[model samples]
Each structure stands twice: as structure tokens, then as C-alpha cells.
Target: MNAQTLSVPAAIRARRTVRHYRPDPVPAELLDELLDLATQAPSAWNMQDRSIVVVSSETGRKALSEAAFGQPQPLEAPVVLVFVAETAAWEAANTDISAQATGSGAWNEQFTAMFESRAEFHSLRDRGLIRENAVKNAMIAATYVMLAATSLGLASAPMNGWDPELVKQAIGIADRDDLAITVMVTIGYTDAPPPHPGRRPRERTVHTELYAG
Candidate 1:
């Protein structure tokens, strides 16, 4: 990673969907730091159910590349992060979060009791809400990792082309039904600088109160 880091805004602008990467490896310490920053992303109810499996080994990257329909990014980048959303983890995390929140005076007994109903709120017959919650939390964390990489002068690519079942097998968690592979991000060094970008007019895309049709 380059020591000349960018400011937050600069990093936001610097991040690119890099497909080509150099073979230079990301240090273990730096990778750990990035992962730590990723977990700092906000979670619903502070339950913090987001997770990532670091796919660093060559064999793992090979599997991930195949899972991504033979995409070269996973194979080219030195590190690939597998973002997993555990739909069932939200209910399991409630107890720990509730207890901690109450202990910290952020929640009282009555408030904590109300929080338990969140399970019922998400437990529709179709389980759609549960999956939605999980994916939202996981994506936020993945975004953090992407920006953090750019801030450190590293390159990253957020990939959505992977087959979920194949990804699960790549991570050795195929038997688990509650987990969903929301996204994967490849992080490494890149020689190519990001190209200039074009954005829609703010008036057209950014509505004030309600959406503009």
C-alpha cells in the first residue's frame, strides 16, 4: 500500500472499479487494519451482523475467480473479501446488543423489551425482510472496505458477478442455509490511474423532499 494516503473526499473520488491489478501483495497488518475499518460501518440496531471472509490464498482466489464466472479480477488482485450476510444472525445478535445497550444507559428495560419485537417484525412468512436486513448491513461494511482501500492508495473492485452457491463452496460454507454472499471485493495494487467520471445533474438525480419522477 502507498504511504501517501488521500483525504476522505479524495479517497471517495479515487476509488475505481479496477479489473487489472499488480501482483504486489497487501501486507497482513494492512489487510487487518482495512477489515477493522470495514466493521466500523453502522449496523441496524447496532447488532453488527456483517461478516467478511478474507480470501488470500492462491487456491482460494482461483476458486473465487471460477465462482465469479472466470473473471480475471479475483485472480489478479492479491486479496479478495467475501462479504456474507447471515439472515438468521440478526435475531441471535439481539440479546448481546440489547444487554450492552442497556448497560451503557442507551436503552432502558422498556426500550429493550420493545427491541425484541424486531424479530417478529422481520419474520414474515416469506423471510424476505430477513434477507433484506442482512444484505443491507453487509453492503455497508463492504463499502467501507472499498473506500478505506482507496484512502490507503490501494485499488479495489466491487464485484457482483459471482454465483452465490459457488461462492459459498469457495468459502467452505455451502451447507449453511442462513448465509448469503452479498458481494465480493478485490483489493490490491494497480498501475492504471482512475479515469475521469461524469455524473448526472444534481437537479435531475437529487430530489429535495420527495423523489422527482
Candidate 2:
């Protein structure tokens, strides 16, 4: 089905955390489109410090499954997308944040010069904050992928049950100190629909005005 046919609300309601998938392989072009859609998710200062590893080969999938402590979803699905956050993206100073802002006409030369100082402050004084920001932005992109996949008539499962060190080694990014493994997503078609565990009511989770503790 085309994206125009599936409304965002419909896709959100229909999405399920699929655990089992048919052996059918996802098309390369379709996966590319999905990835493109995912990158559209907003990031801090438009740094977009996220990277994805697409594991479609049997060997890669097996390695990822092993790293994930034998979780069968990675093995069962035709494609496993691994999201990573490059924590050191801010180190680039002008390239990561300033260039995007200037190119998009969102900032002028004066603002670009101003942002460089702010970026330096974060890199030097708020390293931990930068890392946290990267992980948060990456997770948002991963969520976008799941919803976009559902819209395109595919099933997805967002997995967090995995060894980060082993996952990095399995995906051959263990040497990169700046990259943090965020989440793994299994994508493919599912025949048996899993039962939906209903969500909690809004009042139970959302707090109005001042959070009444």
C-alpha cells in the first residue's frame, strides 16, 4: 500500500511488536526509502548524529542474535536495523551543527559564529549532556522507522534486550569509542499477529499543569 493510503493514526493503531516473521525478504529500495524517512526525524541543532547498520545476511543476523542473548526476533526477521548514536558528533564544531543551519537558511553568518562557541561549550563542559542528547535523538529516529515500516505494510519489533558490547563487536563497530549502540529493530512481514497488550489510560501517565505528586 502507498503511504498516502495509510494515515498516521491508522498506522499507529495497527502497529504491533512483531516477534515472528515470514522468510520473505524486504526489497533493497523499500528499505532505503524507509531509512530516508527515518532520518527525517528531528535532532538537536540538526546535528543528526545517528547511524544505522542494516543486517540482512544470514551470517550478520546470526551474529546479532547471538549478541542479543539468543533473542529469536533478529534471527526470524529478514532484516535487523541497528541504530547507533555518535556521541562525538559535536566535536566537528562547524560541520555537524553550523553547516546544516547555514545551508538550510535557518541561520546567518553571525549566528553561525555564535553557534560555534556554544558547540565548543557543550563539547568541553557538557560532554555527558551531549551523549545523552545523541541517544535521545537516535531513539526518535528508530521510532520513526517502526511507524514508517508499519505504514508501508511491514511489521517491526524494537528490541533493547541485548549486550551493547557484544552488539558493537558483532556489527564491527566495537573500535569506535564515540558510537553508542542505541537500539535494534527487526523488520519484515508477520503472518501470526501477536495479541496487543493494551495501553494505560492517559490520566495514569500524563500529569496536567503542575505534576501533582
TM-score of each prediction? 0.90, 0.91
Candidate 1 lDDT tens digits, 10-115: 9887788899999999988788889989988988777677789999899999999999999999999999999998777755536878888999999888778767
Off by over 4 Å in 2: 1-5, 94-97, 120-127
| Clashes per candidate, residues 3 or more apart or on different chains | 0, 0
Q: List the residue pairs that clash in candidate 2.
A: none
1-213: candidate 2 lDDT, tens digit per residue: 344645689889988999899999998877888999998999876678898999999999999999989999999999999999988876675464677678899989987886676655466435557677888989999999999998888899999999899999989988998999999999999998788899998887889898864
What value does the lDDT take at residue 90 in candidate 1? 55
Give the number of colliding residue pairs in candidate 2.
0
Q: What's model 1's overall lDDT?
A: 0.87
lDDT (0 to 1) per candidate: 0.87, 0.86
RMSD of each: 2.1, 2.2
lDDT of 1 at 211: 86
Model 2: lDDT to the true structure: 0.86
